[model samples]
Target: MNTKRLGTFVAAILVLDAMAHLYWLVRPASDPRALSMAVLNMDVPFTPRVLLPLILLLTTAAIAIVAVSRGRGGWPAKAVVFALGAGLLVRGALGLVWSSGLGTDTGTPFYRLNLLLYTPVCLIAAGSVGLVLARTRRTGARV
Candidate 1:
């Protein structure tokens, strides 16, 4: 894929990640359900200290992947994208598993949302990055 298309896809992935983080951050921390879930050790709540820095790291990585992938030599760019992509995929899968077995009850809605729905979104973003990397490699772009 060309730089423009690659950039667009990566940008979209970043936007999706931001939106998910926003939802998690804005949700009421002290909600009775959340606390109830916490009692069961199922729903660990989000703190700004954790979420904000995570967001920053992910954002920086996204930008770096775009820049390095587009700049001179290709391997470095591909490596960055692959590393981040695979990491996200693993994180998302683990998050899903955590969501499934967590909280007061097996049927908690948060579990369904986080594990079932959102996990795949992260995986798809990771897969997109992988696809772009494969394309770059096929084109024989040197790192």
Candidate 2:
């Protein structure tokens, strides 16, 4: 798809993600991490439990606009796109590390959720930003 639509898709995903986190923020008792902690001994803090998702929503909203604006004409657009891609990629890649290779068991549903759900979403987001970044490179080609 074109840059605007791709950005829209990413924004929609971010909105959905934020909504999920919103559910947790509203009903902390029902937060999924509670199960992860109870079953797998992982502890997520308030930063990630609430703030990060809100930040992600805001950032994605900004980046979505940037990604569709003017086809990467300036440093601001490039920076936003790069930051967005990097954040998503790190979320997916680092999540793999975070959930694996400790005394931690990889077979639990917590890890499974990251594997099956979170990581894929992140990678897809990164790919969307990456596409926008790719167009920036091509359009920036010197004569």
Candidate 3:
């Protein structure tokens, strides 16, 4: 995909991920069912106390990178795509371990959801970058 589309896609994933986490952060403690469920399902550390601002900062950075890279074509886009994908892949593996028994708890639903979501997103993003890089390399070889 082109840089613009790639950046937009990356940004979308970042925004969605951030929003999902933020939703969990803002949920009230009074709702016993939800609070209990949250305690059981989510493993995130911040709660509203720390999570909201951090997510916003991360999403903003992703969006800003997209906005700035609109005109550029080449390594920047590829790098970001690869970085995002690699980050996810590594984290997902770690999550599997954490959820399986390595950690104190299996983690929250919110954490699990992000972990699951990142699997495919990272695959697509990283695969796209790898494919592009391979094609470019082959074409360069021909020339």
Candidate 4:
């Protein structure tokens, strides 16, 4: 598969997500339903609310650089992709515990929205990146 395309896809999603987070961070009231995409129904410190998405944005940027660069190889690429996948997995899917019929909802739309929508996207992006990285390693292509 084309790792560059996958990287682009991941970058696009992460950029959008980062923008959304940044918006919410700067204007915390703009988020409809008043629930966080990263944190569930609980109150979060300003640090995570601002930094998580910013850090994720940087991670995606790095992934895009590695994927698009011709020098893509070695542990650097692997480490970046690994970190991206792990971060997305944690931020996206894990929130299902509070939203997915676990019966602990704070009754915010974000829970359902996250569980049904963005989290899946995150998982897909992460999986695609991992698949591309693995393919690159297997075929010895400069993914």
Instruction: Give all TM-scores, in the order shown.
Output: 0.63, 0.68, 0.52, 0.70
RMSD of each: 4.7, 4.4, 6.0, 3.8
Give me the displacement of residue 64 in model 4, in angstroms.
Answer: 4.6
Compared with the true structure, all predictions reach lDDT values of: 0.63, 0.65, 0.55, 0.63
* Backbone N/Cα/C clashes per model: 3, 0, 5, 0
Determine which window of 10 residues in candidate 3 has minimal summed lDDT. Answer: 134-143
**What's the lDDT of the predicted structure labeled candidate 1?**
0.63
Candidate structures ordered by TM-score, highest first: 4, 2, 1, 3
Task: Judge candidate 2 at residue 115 and give its lDDT.
Answer: 67
Better of 3 and 4 by TM-score: 4
The residue ranges of model 3 lying beyond 4 angstroms of the native Cα positions read 29-42, 72-86, 93-116, 127-143
Which lDDT tens digits does candidate 2 get at residues 1-143?
77667767777776675665565566555565675474335775544545565757555655544555346435655666677789889988866775675544676666777767777888988898788667656766311
Q: Candidate 4 at 38: error in angstroms?
A: 8.7
TM-score computed on alpha carbons, candidate 2: 0.68
- Model 1 segments beyond 4 Å from truth? 1-7, 19-45, 68-79, 95-105
Write the residue-wise lDDT of candidate 3 on 13-126 in tens digits.
778768766776776445645644443344345456666786866576465436433533355544554565567567656656655556534456645654566445655655
With candidate 4 superimposed using the best TM-score fit, by how many Å does residue 66's alpha carbon deviate from the native? 5.0
lDDT for 96 in candidate 4 is 58
